[model samples]
Target: MAPNNQTLGNNELGAWRIFSLFMLLIQKGPLPSAEIYAAIYSDLSTDSALRTFSRDRTVLKQLGFAITEVKTGKEKSFYLSDSNFFNSSYDLSPEDANQLLVICSAILTDATFVYQEELRNALSKIVGNFYSLESGKSDSQKLSASSQNKVFPVLYESLSSKQLVNITYTNSQDLVKQKHLGVLDFFVSQRLLYFVAQDFSSGTESASIKTFRVDRVLDAAILKNESFSIPEEFDSKDYKLLDFQLGLQADTLTAFVPKNILAAFEHFSQGQGDVELLSNGALWTVTYAHEDTALSWILAHGLIPRSPESLLAKWKGSLSEVANGC
Candidate 1:
């Protein structure tokens, strides 16, 4: 057992040594093989180290490191061709570093931001390396756990591992229910976190794919043994909470938006619409699922539907009913 443990330790060290060699070559490159072996393995005989390095070169190439070799006379020089490895050489100027420090300071001090502690810690580490930045001070007005939704990390893990989870969810109507979900993807919109997932339990009258507000989740338990895969056709980009519909089919909505609401609409649509600025407002054409939620948004915003006679007639009927009730 002792010998086996020692072997395992040696294997781990060997792997790290190989990675270090890659990083060294990436930082200071086009070096001859003799020089690389001398820098990394001074303890080994020159001939033996050269042979081992030559074999490791093939291993690095197979791992997609983009190692390039250039021949000069009887010697071969090697370097990493990936631009990302060389980005560290481009150091930020003092002015740029100061600007980053200011921005990070502002964000770190703001308690309203989501993941505020995590963001502040990350920024502190980065800024600390360049300039002396003060540690984050505790705020008296820190957000409560309920408002922060502590379930974010659990949902993130479920989504990453493709695991199924049992969730106690509070619906829009304030009804509480339990559900088994195969986590798919997550996104934030309108300062709210939402998950796009597949319902695995029975009595799902709607589409199998649906979205759930993370904040409304009262409890979640990950099912480690139960794993699921997302459908090949499902794309998270096609679905958005702002669109007000979860259905896969969509129809083009043409309307004139007021100048005040144009920016809000653009934020929700994520620049997925065609807009032409007019003297009074903007003429916009965007795609949305033909659902009650979509119709309600158009009515709420007092938008005039420019196409689809059925939709126009429905909108008129809705207004008539509202006026009659009043």
Candidate 2:
């Protein structure tokens, strides 16, 4: 229904359309077809847009991306109920068996199950944090050791009380050492447990924030009566610090993708950025966390950089290096 010519390839335009549909649902949450039609199919007449929407929806359903339509008083609205992104299968480790033992010890130590309320309230928080919900065939997270298990409860306590702690941590090289830290928070990413803390072992004046995987901690002792303050400007958001999002400089990049190869770019964009579908190609605008990140995407997708001379130079240099290698 929408215009598709050799000027811009079908894949690019098609992918953008699909990605836009998904993002439309994400940004606005529940959206009725009328709103979607206006946003995506405004160029088409009502009849044409309806036909196009039906075809796209059918294809998406076939792909197993469940976009559910709920009946809302004579009108239907779409909603994305869930995603399997974090519902991953993890195999239980020996450390998990170790945790099972610790759990049993805890429950047995508690004499009065009375209402089971107090026991439930206490163990729930610690167990839920690192529980292997279901053991599966995949070996995603193997255990380093359960020694960190001893330290975690102390870390959790300090985090709640704003108390400082002294800990001995073992690195990948097996080098073990002790340091004082102020635990800020704990988070799970990709099924592993990690805590963010400020290292103040040297002194409160030279404290530095860092993320430590829970399993690496060898020992912990809560420093009672000792506490620390987080820096006022410390924003939790700026610290997701996932590898791709971390870089030396942040730049909003402009990329021109050929008509045919647009799908790849669209897929990468996930409709989180701006896109201008032109007769010849698609102009995509997004911010890259670093020059290397920009170069990686552009080189992989064969995109032409239209702005940011620095990125263009880096692209050229990469191409030159590749040519020399060949």
Candidate 3:
């Protein structure tokens, strides 16, 4: 049993050696089986070496190496098909490259972000690969400065440390109010950053979740003495901003969307619709809470509502009003 175990270990070591040798040889150029066997295992007999090489070739293919066999006259040689396999390079389109540069420039120019230095260093490495140092620096300097959100850093810190925060916020109606909140998460929407928090002003046990626009916050201070735990069942996705209207009841609405504006409709709906393809267009069924948003989307995209007679009539009436105005 000891001798058998030693033999198995030796076999495994030999298998790894063959695999490495095969990879090295194929990367340099195609080599015939005889040449590969001779180069890898000089001590073994040609027949034995050839058998091992053949087995290892199968293993290499299974491991996702793009090794292809080519027949030059009578001899077969194996070579890697993908030339850039060992040193892969990203091939971004011109537009995508420009966009990436723009975003990196924005991040580098913005001094308010907490991770500014780290982010700049990382982005410099990536952008440096494509653009010259002088060009990258020039672009960064030319980029527009970010709109300052004074409370953003404070909210970020509170969210990270699981601490309570007291904020003085101005509502849309220009009324100022102060509240204590338990931070849950943060997200960006429509170029504005918002925080999802639990309202502690209503008391702890019956606290309700709410979203606060960071830009509207007049002042924010972290409460170091108090900390809060996030609910085990809470998911950030469930608290994302939906549309302009809040707390409105959602109704299932169906529309026949023309092919030309289908993409626009999908973008407005945020991919929340069931779609069926037609020869000329697509039929979409969506659940929307905001009537004004839905109405504007329908008018803009020339969408035809298919169900809920009341909605269809409303759309027609709106179109009629527009027609009269024209």
What tens-digit string does per-residue lDDT give for candidate 1 at 204-306? 4332988886656767778889877778899877555564544354677777788778767676556656788988878877766655666787887667777
Scored against the true structure, residue 273 in model 1 reaches a CA lDDT of 60
Q: Which 10-residue span in candidate 3 carries the lowest summed lDDT?
A: 141-150
Clashing pairs in 2: 7-280, 8-259, 9-259, 9-260, 12-262
Model 2 per-residue lDDT at 191: 44
On a 0 to 1 TM-score scale, where does candidate 2 land against the true structure?
A: 0.39
Off by over 4 Å in 3: 1-148, 247-268, 271-290, 301-303, 306-311, 321-325
- Best TM-score among the predictions, by candidate number: 3
Local accuracy by lDDT, each model: 0.62, 0.62, 0.61
1-326, model 3: which lDDT tens digit per residue?
Answer: 11123433564455435444644654477877567666666667878777766777666555445567799778888777675343233443444444444443333323333344444344334333333222223453321223222354566556656788998876657698998988777544433345688888766576788877655666778998888888887876666654432334567778898999877766765555589989899998877677767766666768898877778888889889988995
lDDT of 3 at 79: 79
Tens digit of lDDT per residue, candidate 2, span 1-326? 23332343565455456655755665566788778888788878989888877777765555445577788888788876576211234434546534433333333223321322333333334343343332221444333234434565677666656789998886646688788988776644334455678998777586888777666675788898998777887765445443334334487778888999887766655454579999988888766666776678677768898878898888888888999995
Q: If scored against the real structure, what TM-score would every candidate get?
A: 0.41, 0.39, 0.46
Model 1 regions lying over 4 Å from their true place: 1-149, 203-207, 243-252, 256-268, 271-326
lDDT of predicted model 1: 0.62
State in Å the error of residue 65, model 3. Answer: 38
